[model samples]
Target: MPPYFYKKRKRGAVSMNYSQAVNWIHSRLKFGIKPGLERMEWLMNQLGRPHTNILVVHIAGTNGKGSTLSFMRSILQEAGYSVGTFTSPYIETFNERISMNGIPVSDSEIAQLAAVMRPLVEKMEEELEESPTEFEVITAMAFYYFGSVNKPDVLLLETGLGGRLDSTNIAEPAVSVITNVGYDHMNILGDTISEIAAEKAGIIKKGIPVVTAAENREALTVIRQFAAKQQAPLYELGNHFSAAAKSRGEYGEIFDYAAPSLQLTSLMTNMKGRHQVKNAALAIAALEVLPLSLSEKEIREGIRQSSWSGRFEEIISTPKVIVDGAHNTEGINSLIDTVQRYYGDKIVHMIFSALKDKPYQEMISLLSEASDSITFTSFDFPRAETAENLFKAAKVQHKSFEEDWKKLLLQKMETMREDDVLIVTGSLYFISEVRNYCRKNFLEK
Candidate 1:
């Protein structure tokens, strides 16, 4: 062997610095989306199976998963338990993906954990003859950090993609939650609702309880088949439990949630939209199944306190700038419902962007119905579709394209009246960037 290669081998897999560790993990992006449990299983074994030690509530869905997880985390924390949450496509920073007690993991802690896992990861790669993907490594990081170091009482694990082969599926969660089945990730997940539901239902473990808010017949059938096959008791929405919105206004929606063992009247969720009622109810249902001692007062207080940023997040009062990460059809429809319910006939200006892989046209069409004016814009991401492409796909007449999204948004907002609304949405990646800018430029002031 050459001297350089021999020296590299001699150095061995040592712990890396923070920047080095992040870069090394990002470098695995080239490995792409290799979905399977084999790599994660191998990695966990090398890490002494830290995931096996933590109590997890595994959540999967096309939308509402993050919100549901947040609601549950808040409730759990209110019940006096330390909670760890693992979510994807973070709104602000990478560290936000792995959080303990609603606070993101510190940078130094992430670096330290990365260093510890580096050698083991390398050994696994060498043995498996293939490196793990970026998500797989991050999943392992969450499992190790939460299970070993942070030691939370419960971990809320959200699936990154399809549930069946997702890296996060390695855990045997106490309960599996599918918030709802929707048409997203068609390229990898599938083409139809049933196909997608089957993939999301993959999280259902044998003898474990499964909870879902999915209403579609096709989707429900798949979930039913899977739960029956796995012998997992299924608690479904609109049947096992239900939430009805009594009143909704600018403040928030008041709803009544009822399950067999628990009932709460006039529960309020800070998260706007009727869909949020269902999300909160699913959180309650999952909490009900767990053998934890919780009170109705704590659950109500927790749901009120729990808030997920970038989902109908109102940033400014005047001109009423709201940002929602409605990337898929179901989410966009929910956005439309909220907009119509709250804003009424007010003039609405929409700023939209989506990934090339998403069904932007369908989403644009649905959004157009709710907005008076639409501006198709692009974000600074590799997968972001250009403004021109989105505009060409748009069928709405009151639509324009703007490549310089920041300048366009600012210029447009300055021209808005008091009652007019500026709704920024489409892709979560796009929403994250715009939301950060809006907070610094608008909210901080």
Candidate 2:
């Protein structure tokens, strides 16, 4: 342990209720996405390096990280192993970021964890003259919870941003999984696929196995080089392991998976889109490479049980409403493919809202291909693009803007014909809001 890891801070425990704790954490958003690990390293050190004792499956990628993590978590749970997962950009509640057996950290646990972090964060600010970002703070909480509070058999750690500099990168993982690399965080990661791939490959460690579904040649080459440099075994999706689609089943995507150790047919994911199949395949490959032995039954049952919300998630049945978290161009492309394949015959109405930082123009352009009728709408977030600004990105025949997403959703839902499908796309945050509204007003009723 580093000498500073034992920084004897003369401080009292910061007390807080649930709301106060959450608000305090949210207030750190002003620090923004400062992409570096100096703060995390310092904070973890002060916390006595709680992350070292835990076994982690460090997952990094632009998009599929959450879905892949869910697959692994489900399978491990099915195999009767306790699994803890740390993921970002929660689809529902803030406590969902740190979970065990798919159950979110409790409100009391969240408050307690926040209390543990408050003092350390204050100490870091005083010593380093810098505040940790919201993500960094949460990563610390996960480490503390899983490390000191309750130690699970394994932890699925998802990088909040780029792998190398993300707050969650301190973990010494048993296996490193990169779902895929793409151009999402260009400003922080880099402008090119190679740069981004290298950033994602930062989780690679000596002798650790790497599993990736990255198909882009440039991205794959960068990943291969990083794996070689680290002397880690590389498992490419289409090369070392592969998932071939059999059909889009009633529940989700059905496919056949093949890897060096095992091969299985009719492996199904309970999430829509072909990309989900790749995620499930990556999950299987990642688990196979882990130190534990997972049976074929566990793998199949686990993948079949796993479902990620806000990714091609269908919220309503009649006059079907689909909510997808396709904030970037690559994700938008996948959404477009799913739409064309499933709702091709229906008259699709697309609602989109994204953060200003995302490639909303390209995303809007791609949504146009999936549905000519497009409506741009904004949500209650700092980075959310204004509905009018999002409207400017669309070049479709039927395009409009609505400042009130609820009003638009209600108007569209009430007026949808029998052959119409309503899709709410764009930012995960926006979709999260939409999902909550639907659950309260429609699904619950």
Candidate 3:
């Protein structure tokens, strides 16, 4: 084994198998979501302070963080630069949280990184009164993996929770990017957009350039104040940079993007939604603000090829089976807008589920506006809301609940006519399950 795999803690350190390591990390959820930087600081100090060694693009937002990061990563990759990313709520595998380019870190690498973090995790639990949460542990692992081992040219870091107290905020990033700010985690982040924007603006470091795609005036005011206080240059969407959708279809979008230094018409993306155009434009603006060298061709091709999982992804074309991870009101609104644009004439049936902590009721109400029939379903997650509860909350007439999502989905698809669309959405976790099921069962056939 390489010395850097475990760094200086190779001696007397406990070695854990992959499953044991992952389970140990997930088990930290018992401590709940303790949001603070003190424990994270102490853990990083013990791990040789690796967070300071790498260049990062810090991204914090409510809905578009993952997709914006994907666009930026694909652009950088298209420009022939290697990129590392840190995102939360893994859709496919636990290792997906820490990845290079688009491929997740190998299981052996995860085992090695877990081995390095396990001892430190134990030390923290013994020394500190409050143990680290699951997010903090994963942040530590990502820091260990990227900051110490297999470092990439650029690391795109996404905040797990609010930006100020988020463990990922410990890193000093070259550029601070906020995809968009909206009402989410109201209990922890605050109830209003201004307060939430304040939390998102916490990532803007002193003298670092800040770029935002937030469209709300209240949110923009808060971000502007924060950036000005930090003396950070601010490049805002619909101001310094903008994107206008020219066309949208079931498979893709074509848009026009413009910035002070660059303007390109008819930019296209495989990813659906007008919001995606805004995300791509924000990504390009962030890259422009950075010191990296990139061409217009790379940016165009990146937008065209970049694909994000669990964000309006089409699973099977027949009956037009689409799945999206729209758990919040803002996300549902965006999904509905896309639906109206593409599937207004078609019969759209939306199957939904979400975490108990989210604003699932309002989300369901918003979803009912576009969906012809809404099916409420729950997954095997600790926080997932009951299908009956979601169904009961729906004010719309065409609504039902099913404990078994597979049966509901099969029935929906089997009964749908050629002009109908079946959408499975609610949470990213749920969409990932549906995505895997469809890939294994329908895509294969």
Best by TM-score: 3
Model 1 — which ten-residue stretch has the worst lDDT? Answer: 1-10
Error of 3 at 204 (Å): 1.1
TM-score of candidate 2 relative to the true fold: 0.96
Number of the candidate with higher TM-score, 1 or 3: 3
**Local lDDT at 369 for model 1:** 93
RMSD of 2: 3.2
TM-score for all models, in order of appearance: 0.96, 0.96, 0.97
Residues 1-445, candidate 3: write the lDDT tens digits. 2556675677658777889889988898898888789989998998889899898999999989998999999999999998999998888889999999889988877778878877777777687755888888889889878888878899999999889999998999999999899989999999899999999999999999999999899999999999999999999999999889998754789999898799999988989888898899999999998789999999999988899988988879887898899988999999999999888898899999899998888998899899899999988888889999999988898899998888999998889999899889888888889888888887532
Please give me the total number of clashing residue pairs in predicted model 3. Answer: 0
| Global Cα lDDT for candidate 3 | 0.89
Model 3 spans > 4 angstroms off: 1-4
Taking every candidate in turn, the Cα RMSD to the unseen true structure, in Å, is 4.5, 3.2, 1.4
lDDT of each: 0.89, 0.88, 0.89
Error of 1 at 438 (Å): 1.5
